[model samples]
Target: MLPLWQLTVAEAAAAMDRGDMSAVDLCEAYLARIGALNDGLGAFLTVSADLARIQAAQADARRAAGERGPLLGIPYALKDLFVTAGLRTTAGSRMLADYVPPYDATVYRRLQVAGAVLLGKLNMDEFAMGSSNEFSAYGAVRNPWDRERVAGGSSGGSAAAVAAGLCAFSLGTDTGGSIRLPASFCGVTGFKPSYGRVSRYGMVAFASSLDQAGTLTRTARDAALVMGAIAGQDPLDATSADKVVEGYAAGLSGRLDGLRVGLAIPEAGDAEQAQLLTDARRILEAAGATVEDVRATADEALIVPTYVVLVTAEASANLARYDGIRYGHHVPGDDLAAMLGAGRGQGFGAEVRRRILMGTYVLASGYQDAYYGQACRVRELVRRRLEATLSPEGGLDLIVGPTTAGPAFPLGAKLTDPVAMYRNDIYTIPANLAGLPAISVPAGFSAGPAGPLPLGLQIVGRRWAEATVLRAADAFQARDDSWRRRPVMATSAASA
Candidate 1:
């Protein structure tokens, strides 16, 4: 039998339902695992053990009262970007390191209502920027597979925790591949729902239009269970969609018959990744789905630049409120302007400042139309191209690709080269541009110098088609047991 800490969300829930485990037992198990492993991984910014115990006990009491839900009694963690009442929400930046919110994010509230225990806040890239976890002020989150390699970002900690079994699952925000990239590196399942499918209220803003809330788990079914718990329209967030939320876990029949799966053949820089793409298509085709190669019309070279422009511009606007006068770090000065300047200068990290400067330049008077405006036009073109290709008339139900160019690279390998770092997100950024649903499932492993490193197969679906995406991923996952292979570090942690 699997240890309590290693059980997936669905398995953990079933254990509790069958009286084999109590919510308190589950929470304590996770706390023990975190205490034992978090120092080596640097996955969490905080561990709210006392609060988690309270929540778990409450869940146990609710279970006694006959209440039932998929996430009931499940232990989980957040990406630290979501505001939780009385919990520090740093967004992985020192600028807001000491800031705590007075109210819960809609997503957090929904999970709490569903009886999921909050383990703590996970680490991320400072202000949700950077492809590697190195930008975090707290420190980089190391991949569980190879401690010297990066876990990817800006949701690095979320993916690491799930992969390492520190928690059953974790919540993460995706903007330009933050969730998917990290999940790929960490060897877990990360699902980024269509924009507005999940509420963004109380989440620290990076790129308002591109940012989305999602989940990281060991399996697509676990992601589906958590998605059902947290996804729906929220009155607090104006951007939330009003469409009916489906019971995602209950609907995962894993039958892909008649599904039209499109194999997106972009310029895969790595030969192994290209082969993985071909294998993914073969797997889907064997499951009774129509598979066809679809050439990418949007130039691969344009994705990173356009994403950089739009996100930086939006980030510059969103970060303007952190002048230290409002709530964050305050540096005293003789005048208001001086005080604001000093506070911002001392509070934000180097990467944050670089992005802010680039954003300001792009949005500046003479350059706005030339840079930011052109980027917007390119974004629209990319979105339209995806829409046309995935439309019913186009006969493509889902687009498949490699989540990353290769596998996890060594930490600090590309930190000095921003362009090189930005290219890490090339494959996953298009889905965010189109506001489409996408997921990264553990594909297989690549032999690394230190050990085996995991790779991912990315499946993207049209707007508001999370069910379809989950179904295809679940079917693919069911076809093999490769995802069950644990990282050496994670296996040691589980045994200890």
Candidate 2:
């Protein structure tokens, strides 16, 4: 059997059920892994050992009482922005570094009800603002595969922690590919459900329209288990779907029979990446699915710009509530304006401030129509284009492509140029814009300057089609086990 630290959520639950291991045992193994790797990797901003032990004990008690569920006794961590009652929920910014929510986020509450243990809060970009984890006020999340490279952004810690065996699985938010991008870099399974598939209540807002709760796990089955636990309607979030949540794990039959897959070769322009997608096409075909290359009618290049304009505009408004009076870092000043300015100026990181300024300018009077308005119109076009192609009558059941343009880059490689950094998400931003379900599965390894870096294959489906998306990914995993690979550094660190 694999070590408890290396067990996937599914494996851990099975082990616990058979009495081979308990939730406490799983918790301790992960805690030890985090203790050994977190300082260098920066995967966790906070480690709640006491809370974890308490939860693990409760989970064991429930299991003893004959409560059987897939997630019961599973240990998982949450992104810092997912507010936890009495636990510091910093959105990776000094502004909220000390703030503790009075209530837990809907997703966290759901996971708790399933008897899952909380490992702690993972680090992220301040206010979930940047493509690279470098924008984090805490510190960049170093890729476990190579400490010198980034683990990817804003959910970098969540992905890193899962890949490094620090947790069974970790919840993250996907706003402009935060979860997918990081999962790709860290070599884990990242699943972003359709918009509104999961409640957003209590999740620190960052482009609320685009922000959706998701998870990073060792495999698609693990992601399915977590999704089944967390995906449901919530009275707290009106945006949450009122529809019934499907049994996600049960849908993973490891077959994609009668499904039509569209391959976006243009998006996978690089020879290596294109070959990976081509291989994926063949794999999907062999799995009882018809695969064919499909070109995008809409210009794919406009995806990033449209996403930036809209998300930044939304972020500018969402972040305005952090004034000193509203419970955040306070800076005293002689006048109200000065006090507010000082508080916000010092509280926000450079990236957050930059985005706020950009958003504010675009939303300014007389410029709204020229920028924000035009961007919204363009966004509608992009969404329509995607919806039309992925609709039931639209010939395609899923779209396959590279999750990112390439593998993880060296830390701070594109930090000086935010545009360059933003472009890294070019392949991923489209799904967010269209409010679709997408999964980034570790597809293959790319030979890098240091060692073999992981590349991810993205499978996107129509909005509210998470089951289909997850099924496709599971089928792919059945053929290729790349998602099961862990970084070498993590192995050595855990052994030490």
Candidate 3:
């Protein structure tokens, strides 16, 4: 039998419903696992043991009182980007290291209302800036598959936590592939909803237009369950869409009959990743879906540069508020302006500073049209092309591709070369740019120098088509059980 800590959110909820285990039992098991593994993994920045216990107790009481919820009593954690009222909400930077939010993010509040237990905050890239977890002020998050490799980021810790069974699920934000990249590296299920599908009122902003709240879970079904709980329009977030939330969990058929799936052939990619894409096509075809090859587009190359420009500009505007006055780390200086510069210089990590500087330059009056404005135009073109390809009248039902160019690389491999590091997000950034729903499902494993590392297959759907994406992912996962294979580190942690 699988240990409680290893169970998926859906599995644990069923177990609790069957009276096979109590909420408290589930919580304690996870806490024990986190305690044993977090020191080595650096997955969690804060483990709210006392608060988790209280939430677990409350969940138990709710279950006893005949109040049933899909997420009731299930343990989860958040990327430190989400502001939790009393819990420390560090955006993986010293700037907000000591800052405690006075209000809860709408997503977290919704999960709490669903009776889920919060274990604490997970680590992330500073201000959600970097492609790898290396930029975190708390120290880099080590991949569970191979300790020396990266877990992927800026949501690396969220993915690592779920992969290591520290939590049944975790909330993460995806701004240019943060959630999906890490999920691919860590071999977990990651789902980034269509922009505005979930409220981002209390989430730390990286890029206002691109950043979206998402989930990292053990399986696609688990993601559906969590999404159903937290996804909806919120008054707090004006950008949140007012569309009716669908019954995502109930809609997962795990059968892709008649679904038109497109295999996005990446441009002369690594051989292993190309094979993974071919393998994914076979699985979908075997499961009764029609598959076709999609030739790479010119706009594909524009994703990274366009994303960098737009996000950095937004980031510059958003981060300007953190100038030693309102909250976060403060450094006293001779005057107000000097103090602001001193505080930001001391508080932000190197990656954050770099992006801020780039953003400021791109948004400057002289370069705005040449860079930022042009990037926005390219972004719109990319979105239009993707929309046409996924349109029901003339195109495919879904698009599939390798989540990353390759598996998790060595920890310091791309640190010095920021371009190489940014390239890591190449395949996963399109959906974010287009404001579409996408998921990264563990497809298979690739042998690494240290050991076997997981590779992911990405499934993308039209805007607001999360149900379709989840169905395809669930069907693929159901057909291929490769996702069931756990890392050796995870196995050792479960036993310990």
Q: How do the residues 1-496 of candidate 3 rate in per-residue lDDT, one tens digit apiece?
A: 4788878888898888888999999999989988888899999999999999999999999999988888999999999999999889999999987898899999999998999999999999999998789999999999999999999999999999999888999999998899999999999999999999999999998899999999999889999999999999999999999998899999888778888988888777778878888888888988889999886542446988998899889999999999778887899777988899899999998988988999999999899999999999999989988999989875798999888888999999999997788878888888999999999999889999988899999999989999999989988888888778877774464544
lDDT, candidates in the order shown = 0.91, 0.89, 0.90
TM values, all candidates = 0.98, 0.98, 0.98
Collision pairs in model 2:
none
In model 3, which runs have C-alpha deviations exceeding 4 angstroms? 297-300, 490-496
Model 2 residue 104 distance off true place after TM-score fit, in angstroms:
0.7
Model 2 residue runs over 4 Å out of place are 296-301, 490-496
In the order shown, the candidates' Cα RMSDs to the true structure are: 1.3, 1.3, 1.3
Ranking by lDDT: 1, 3, 2
Model 1 earns a TM-score of: 0.98
lDDT at 481 for candidate 3? 84
